[model samples]
Target: MPVHQVNKTIGEINERIRKGKAVVVNAEEMARIVNKEGKVKAAREVDVVTTGTFSPMCSSGLLFNIGQQPPVMKVSRMWMNNVPCHAGLAAVDCYLGATEPSEDDPLNKVHPGRFRYGGSHVIEDLLRGRAVHLRAQAYGSDCYPRRELDKDVTLADLPNAWLFNPRNCYQNYNAAVNLTSRTIYTYMGPLKPNSRNVNYATAGQLSPLFNDPYLQTIGLGTKIFMGGGIGYVLGSGTQHVAKPPRNERGIPTSPAGTLMLKGDLKQMKPRYVRAVSIVGYGCSLSMGVGIPIPVLNEEMAWFTGVSDADIQMPIKDYGYDYPNGLPRVLGHVTMEELKSGEIELNGKSTPTVPVTSYSMSLEIADELKKWIEDGKFLLTEKQEDIVSL
Candidate 1:
């Protein structure tokens, strides 16, 4: 590790926040300050920088502890709103994956599956205080004789509901394009044939992991804003690439670090935790995640000061390379270029659309900033730092 010009601890930052003396800003503002006054000065002046990202995260899921019924049946199979949930845990405990399509969904019956309803919808409905039909089955046992269970339950009726996502908030991702002659529907949204359009999902510099590229201050027990509520970083999320290809600025130019997050579902709002259905890809959860980066040193300030123009994403071909698992890089494009609605590809200006909502990310960052400013939120020292290679 290199020597830092400025040093401030999480404890010091929290104390300043409690005293209403902490200087906080969003990632965009931090970038501007660093550009104007330099990173050393920005580190000394800014206590924290808030970052956010809102995108369709398919790896999200819910853990539920449905109330026990009369006779105390041990659930072996469970379904909530026609979507199957893993009930291999304790009697009434179940895990509902966001992308688990409903049993009644006509998946690819007509060539492309229209997964209208799924686990993500069920979760959103529950959070909105709507009733969900629950059904379960179990083989009779001596201690627990009940074999069947059926009921309609709301979030309030559940003993515990946790939004425990395996992965969320990817640091950076690829900009997808279809090189084939036919249109294709994928998780990145439908791609027009012959590279007619580009679809990318990420909040660029406003992304949490991007602001803390090396995961210097983000780790186990790090407090965060998740789905419009308080949450924590359980650890480095699934598919976390410790060392990915980077540009000159040390920012990853491809899919990289991810976060495993958990929060109380009861505290989350419907708006921040939405259900999404891709045209033919299937169901997913569009969630909002915001993380506060403590400007503990000049290095931290420099990382958080990255702007969209400074960040780049690899161009990928969804029609072939991605599906074939080939590591072929079509090219690279900057977030500024992607957000400009177009990018040059093979001498043609291709239309670009962001699957992730940058505006929503900005709102989350601002909301987190308000929480810190009002002393409703504070920073936490990580019990263990996320591994970096």
Candidate 2:
């Protein structure tokens, strides 16, 4: 097997980036280069590859440090815009999950209600400089006297607003379809009866984890583009499977790795962090995330060279099998075939749609590349690698 004669270090790559001399390319471009010139040549020429994904991440949430009341009341319960928040932390600190539905939403009274607003909408409203009604209940105490508090506050009024997402950027995911006769709604959107339509989410070859497969350069303390601002990888996210089944290209065929990410909400753009509501499911936050992989060795170069055709996802039946906790997989399909607007399944050509925005992902990857080329972004050495088994 041929090997690249050059082996670069992250420090060397950062130095070159600082001097505006580093070679940076998006994952798509790197795949083409590897396809034509092979991994050996590609590794010798490229310094960095940028990857991106923009999708509805339900595990995302916001952390806020609302200022204490005048008498220092200890908040026992809190609600922002009628959406309940987890207030078991400090006196004034609270965490609001993106999927928390409003208490007054008609879903409580009606089946398959349209969940218009929820925690995600409140988050977006706050980020956009809008004030939300805040209500808190507290048990009166001698040290902390004030009990009831009601007011409207904007993001600026809070001491700290942070986006702490437990999971985002799923490495690979399921292509959902309905196997029953009736329609059903899920986080993947609505599925038509009898597998009439398929919905999948991922940026394919441009996804950060897909490009890094084994978590080589992506890990703790690795800097990334989070919701249009700089952020850091906290650790392995929830439901992250270290070792899942793989295809010939060494890519996971099932839902695999995930990222735990955190960033300053004050620096995020409203465009990159928006609210989304499923017809019958609930609310979620759609976010844009980008990770840069430094080409430090032949293996790194080869991994970044993976393309849509090389990546595949398992097909899952959401109508009956998934809801019943069955692990049966209907089949597998490549990202290339999914992107072509159709796929052959069960002896029929089925229509498909991507729940995530591929165009936004491309824009993010391009923007990250520009940040590196302009000497504004620098790669960081990971303190520890994400778990890989």
Candidate 3:
């Protein structure tokens, strides 16, 4: 790979961004430009490359101020649409988790509440303009004498309601295959016993963190398209693991860099951000995130050229005993191989299905570019070198 001297600085990039003259392209188009125009030419032509993702991030929830009632109370216990929410924050604030099921749900008594609706569903309903029944109880403090109350609430009914997800994106995920005799259930979606089907998550080459495996460009305060609203990267996600096995392109072959996303839930569009209940799996929030990377040099242009063929990953046997020992690796496969719709496994061809939506990601990338072009969004200044290796 040929490296060219970079004349562009962070200041220069921001200046172009501010003036709405920055040359920007989505990951897909950038890859094409790099392949045909070559790195040096592409690097100089492109200032920013946008990347995106839409995945099931269970580590998400809603923060709501259920409005000021006559008898104000620091809500200790609460339920919305029959689904319980965590009211442990403050008098006016509450946190409703995506995976949290109703305590009184009968499904909890039997097994994981696969069909039981949770906080995530409530969030979607609110976004859809559906009213949710809100009930709360308090010890009745002198300042807040309310004991119990019931009312219906929507996103409009609350003064402040937004999604504050500590972690929302996983960099690299496992290709799930079941080798067990019985059907196994997992967060990767259900795996058919005996390698009957293969399910993979994440848009490999199009993923934001996958393109910036080293986290060199993406860092805290980076502006992004979160769900339907503009969101910013707060910091490293909860289970962030920077260093992972890499391919020739330096893309991780295992679970690697993750992102913590935050944005205004009220501004979010339900189409781009919604909650889902995967049958027999769990409740999760499906959200879209788009991050733009500044190609300040030729090296970055080369990095942007990474294709599905260059993105390597392992097929983790979801059937294997986890934690006690590493998940057994069934085999190694590239993003191209997986995207081909099939990968040869154990001398037999196995079909691959995607759990996450790639089209959603592509849409986010284009939307983000428009946001920049219209001057509605600006690239945020890096506050810290938090993404560095």
The C-alpha stretches of model 1 lying farther than 4 A from their native spots are: 106-112
Flag regions of model 3 displaced more than 4 Å: 1-4, 18-20, 104-112, 323-325
Those runs of model 2 whose alpha carbons end farther than 4 Å from true positions after fitting are 1-4
- Give per-residue CA lDDT, model 3, range 45-148, as digits (tens): 99888888888889988888877779788889999988888888889688898888766667766885565678788889998889999989898889999899
Q: Ten consecutive residues with minimal summed lDDT in candidate 1?
A: 105-114
Worst 10 residues of 3 by lDDT: 321-330
Sequence-dependent TM-score of model 3: 0.94
TM-score of each: 0.98, 0.97, 0.94
Clashing pairs for predicted structure model 1, backbone only: none
User: Mind sharing the TM-score for model 2?
Assistant: 0.97
Which rank order by lDDT, best down to worst?
Answer: 1, 2, 3
Which of candidates 1 and 3 is the stronger one according to lDDT? Answer: 1
lDDT of candidates 1 onward, in order: 0.93, 0.93, 0.82
* Cα-based lDDT at residue 186, candidate 2: 94
